[model samples]
Target chain A: MNKKYYRWLILILALLVLTFGAGIISLLSGEMDIPWHTLPDILVQKEGIQYSIVTQIRWPRIVLAFSVGGALSLTGAILQGIYRNPLVEPYTLGISGGAALGIALVVVLGLHLSMGSYMLPLAGFIGSIVTIFLVYTLSFRRGGININRMLLIGVMISFVASSMMMFLMAITSSENLHGIVFWMMGSLDEPNALLIDIMLYASLAGLFISYLFARPLNALRLGEEKARHLGIHSTITLRILFVVASLLTGICVAVTGIIGFVGLIIPHIVRLVIGSDYRILLISSFLGGSFFLIVSDIIARTVIAPNELPIGVITGLAGGLIFIVVLTRANVQSKIS
Target chain B: MAVYLNIQQLVCGYNLGFQLKGIDLKIEKGAFAGIIGPNGSGKSTLFKAISGDLNIQSGLIEMNNKKLSSFSLREKALKMAVVSQFNEVLDVTVEDYVLMGRMPYRRNFQFFETKEDLIIARKYMRLTNVYQYKDHLMTELSGGEQQLAAIARALTQEPELLLLDEPTAHLDISHQVQILNLIQHLNEEMGLTVLIIIHDLNMAGEYCNHLVMMNDGNIHQHGNPHEVLTYQNIETVYNTVVIVRENPVSGKPVVFPVSEKTFKKTTNTSS
Candidate 1:
């Protein structure tokens, strides 16, 4: 193989190894001290307290982290591609505010108490889809989605949603208020097997669909007019990607409240390493994001042992640092170009 | 033979701010035409209308005797390719960028480009003389080289009607000539119909057989360069004094602006 292919191969292999190593570390280093020597037997035989801790508790968290991180990054990649703007991310279009409002309604109305654990996520998912659909419909002008208008509308809707959520919070009992605030701050505390499985499958489906549109997404990065000239149906492509991004973002936010920067920064990091070909960019981003969140979650767990920090805090701090570095480097590169 | 492109009473604009009003023009098969005018003369707007990028308010654009709007965007793309000013610095490889031109031919949902697509991309890259930089990132090339790569990408579309908007605006003298000459050679040898918008009248005169001088969203004059590039025609439309003379080498019209000092000196010499 030529140099480029060889380098890509090496990079993929290295990422796979790192992801595997990180998964093992995550599985072993949780609160319950499962002996490292018996870890293989625990995984295979699936018995005893250690196995239960590893399988029922740690495994779901780890898998959920991977799925959520992968979904967010893939969402970011697609949004950036469709917008032709690198700064865009999953929540940039107001999905977070919408999902938060959904949960707020559920909590304030005491619906979750009656309907059980699935109610919050279901409501959040519905709210997100509705909000996205509304924003999309509002932005449609002359048979095309005006991106600038769409962004503005999304921001406006976000403000409205947040204010409504605050209203709901104000009228709620102190007990429900505390619960609402914690969920809004974002968490991965509860690991539901069914929800994680759904999100995992949804993220994989989103990734597959994104891969199928890779060529057109590549064309889209050149700009809409050019992509249209190339016969890529720029409008249809943008709409499809918008739906996919919204679904992925909705599902992620529904399960784990707004983990901010996995979507924003992971794609940028992947692009920096792998270059801008969407075919490779999407796959690498999924892997890179999975690895990043696994490591970040590990840090979140072990930093103040027995009492874990929210994963968002870690990702936000690291994402902020990375953003500054990326901004500066982009400035320097722009000047050079 | 049928007219390859026909635009009649075309009026288009972006929400009442700026408009191309009642512009009419036509291009015959295997002919090179240049659209020239002062800034804001609706030249680019006319190109947009023809390319179906702008929605026509009230007008008719026909390609191959069919309404331009009748064809799908892909059909339009397969018929005509445009090379406009690409100001953004795209982070794509030269070869991959060129491969975008073959997008019209590929089926929807087809991700991988075929061998034939690669061959066509390489063919155009070689034609535009940017084949050596096929693997190089677009950012790594100079502005002139990038412009050539853009042209190569346009050529890869295999268009019958090639439209260019100020393609040589940012190139050096040598690069400008090199680009114009390449475009000229393509029109002549490949029998491609060319409609180029150029601010430089001299280059337009040299490369384009016909000229369409636009003024205030309308065609001011349209004919051979010798007829449209006259001093009276340019002075009236552009509101500037210029000396129009023939190039001794090619016997084509060359326009030179008559600045105050140069006009005085030239008058003194002539008297």
Candidate 2:
């Protein structure tokens, strides 16, 4: 590979290594330290000293960290491609607010769907999809959907949804309020495998769908008129984008409230490394996002020690720092575009 | 040459108002035709109507032997390619951007261009003398290079009818001559029925087989360059007196803009 290619590869690989390394650190050193050698025995065997401290609790959280990391980054990458706006976040379609409203209302209502385990994420998923469909139909017309109108309508829907959440929060019992508040803060340690599984599956499904759209998304980078003139139906492409991205945002948001900026920053960082080609950008963004989120999750766990910090705070902080580094690092005005 | 397109009682305009009034014209197949006029004379407007970019307000258009609407967009694209104004798209490679012309023909489910498509794209890119820059970022190229790539893109479509809007709009002298000569070669070798909207009267005189003069959206005259581009036609249509002479090398009609003193002196004495 040439210098440019090598640089990006090195950075992406380094990020991946950091992600895995951080997860390992989080797994081994959290609260109770299980010796590194005994960790394997806990994972593989039924007869060995049961290191439940390492395997039972930490391992699942580690997997959740990796999966959620990948999911958040992929959602951001796909959103950037469809919107053709580098600054666009995962919630451009109002899925986060919609899901937030659903989850918040459910929490405030004292619904113990965690008993079923699938019900909470399902509610969030359904809410996001419904809102996405509503936004798309409102913006779509005889042929194509207008991006500005879609964004505006989504934000409008988000505002209304936020108000509804607040209104529901106003009347909820003080006891349930604590859980709802923590959930809204966004967390990685849901301690519920079924909910995490649903999100993991949804994220994987969304990623697969995004890969299928790689070629069309590249054409769309030239803007919709050119994309349409090139024989790809702009309307249909936008619809698929809406639904797949909605599924991703819905599932992620349902599981972990609202984690901002991962979607906006990850794709741009990938694009800077891998030019504007959607094929490369999409994959790299997925990797980078997964790595970024994993690393952030580790920091969230370690920085507060016994006290847990919201996953969103870590992401927002990392995203802010990455954005500044990306902007200032290169002669970006020329190389960036 | 037989008539390739016949437009009758056509009115073309946007929602603001009618730009092109009622018009009637016929373009012969394999003709290198140029429509020349001053700005706001509806030259581009007329072409848009003919190309179906703007809906014909009131008219019947017959292309080849069928009504205009009978042919689908694919069929029309196969017959015609439009090289619009020299717009810039510097993000893509020169080759892929050209391959987009084949979009009107190919399937759209994210398949890369077939080998045949690649060969065609390469061939046209080479023909336009932009093959060396096939992998180059479009933004890195000069203005002339971009225009040439756009022409290559239009050619890659392999259309029978080539409609260009001021293909050499802002190019320097060498680039202008290069585009005109390249277009002339395409017309001669491929028998491509070329219709270009150009403002350069001298370039049109030398390159076009037939010259069409438009004034206020209606054809003022149309014939072989020698017959139609007369001093009287120039004076009446452009409201300017001009001397028309044959070029010594090409033996084509060339116009020389006349000063007002000469026009006034001649009109006063001769009238």
Candidate 3:
């Protein structure tokens, strides 16, 4: 038992170190090539072009990436525990589509121009909230929420939301269409410090709240009936966890447009490495996601150097390839053992 | 002995038309009782109502002189632990799985199992003979082993009443005997109240001190093995001709189904 605990500690420490390294690399290797050795001096000086660029441009994006990635992945792990299906993620419930549609509608109507830039994220947040409310209410029966019905409803709503988004795209002007598509692809270029701070703090708070229910989440792995037999109020647990996961996903989508695959892939990778014990799965997935997104962001900016690609493009390509490789190796290793 | 579990005119069912209509029963403290009946006989529904899985439409279920509905889920879990028929074999280790039984005892905001919880879990794991497979994932264990693991987890709950629904349905004969023996030991030595839903009449007769014969959502008979396992009751309830005879060694009743051919041959020869 002690050995197992120690092993988890080592794995978590390794992830922390890796995340720190990814953060440093992200800070140093943006469009302006700041040298690694000069980082400490630049921190002390605080007045050069490099200092301003690091603090203003790259640092906020890095913070945004960590929180968004961590929140999405954490929500994925929680939702999977709730639904008991591995294929579930924040986006599986049409949260991203809803947020994207909201942003598209706002851009086409030129709401951001009139109301200010905050209108974009506000619309996105409202849109996701509305979608989750619809899904939650529609799947609710006489007294309890049916998980299978919720998943089916979520999928159908996703289809509906995407079709609606496409219709909006069809009627909008080309300039507005460009804005909509760019936002849909996702980016971590939010310049608002307050929003970044909120995301960071909210993600951390989500992580802490999730830890309180780690044991319940583990109980749920035995199925809801057995979980209830073990003394968990499965219905209440499901409801609270559903709302928490959707809200986190809503906030993430509202803030970052839609960064796909981190939520889906990070948890799978972390579970493969560490066991399915939610106490560790939740934290590890959060850190692993932050590490993955930071690295993906680094690649997104540097691969094209002057012309930056959207972070979602890099995340999908890199995250998918890495997941495939990890899965293949895990399959082969299981066969060998 | 005091009545440990009392049900008065219980009426409950799923929305699919199956219902347990106005059922009343009582189980004495520390009694090894079995509920036996055919499929769709509301055996599972009755069990569900008692376990708080199904909403009781009307009537009262009291445990230890307190209404069952008054107890919170955690309090109910502290009083009774259920070993269900089917459980998803997850990727969790047996030790971890067994430790889940300690959930009811967990304090608010408790993240990990306490030392006391671990000791209790290990005790039950040893009792059920699953300690050797503690580190193995539940998916890796055989069906019988998994069932034993499930029992170990239930024992870890330290419940006063242990409820099992068809625990041995999927096990081999030897495994079935092994599990029943363990349950009997828990009942006899620890004075745990056991109410099991069993399909095997012979096993029920062998192990249970009292039997409740259920037919069409109501109790057909409730008494000692000798009185409840009679061939007439079996034939009437199960819709089959069965021969009930005494076991030479244990002196308990044993049932033998009389097939159509044997019945016909016996009728013709007698004529």
* DockQ list for all candidates: 0.57, 0.28, 0.70
Error of 2 at B69 (Å): 5.1
Q: How large is the C-alpha RMSD of every model relative to the true structure?
A: 2.7, 4.5, 1.7
* Alpha carbon deviation, residue A157, candidate 1 (Å): 2.1
Candidate with the larger lDDT of 2 and 3: 3
TM-score of each: 0.93, 0.81, 0.98
Residue runs of model 2 more than 4 Å from their true location after superposition = A1-29, A32-40, A46-72, A104-123, A142-145, A163-181, B1-29, B37-79, B86-88, B99-119, B211-221, B226-248, B251-271
**Across residues B19-107, which tens digit of lDDT does each residue of candidate 2 receive?**
78888888888989999877777898888877766678788888897888787765777787787775546466788678777766766
Candidate 1: stretches off by over 4 Å: A1-10, A170-173, A322-337, B15-21, B260-271
Q: Is the docking of candidate 1 incorrect, acceptable, medium or high quality?
A: medium
Model 1: residue B97 alpha-carbon error in angstroms: 1.5
Q: Which candidate wins on lDDT?
A: 3
TM-score of 3: 0.98
Q: For candidate 2, what is the recovered fraction of reference interface contacts?
A: 0.15
List runs of model 3 lying over 4 Å from the truth.
A330-337
Q: DockQ for model 3?
A: 0.70
Sort candidate 2 into its docking category. acceptable
Model 3 lDDT per residue over A235-272, tens place: 88888888889989999998888999999989988887
Candidate achieving higher DockQ, 2 or 3:
3
Query: Which prediction has more favorable TM-score, 1 or 3?
Result: 3
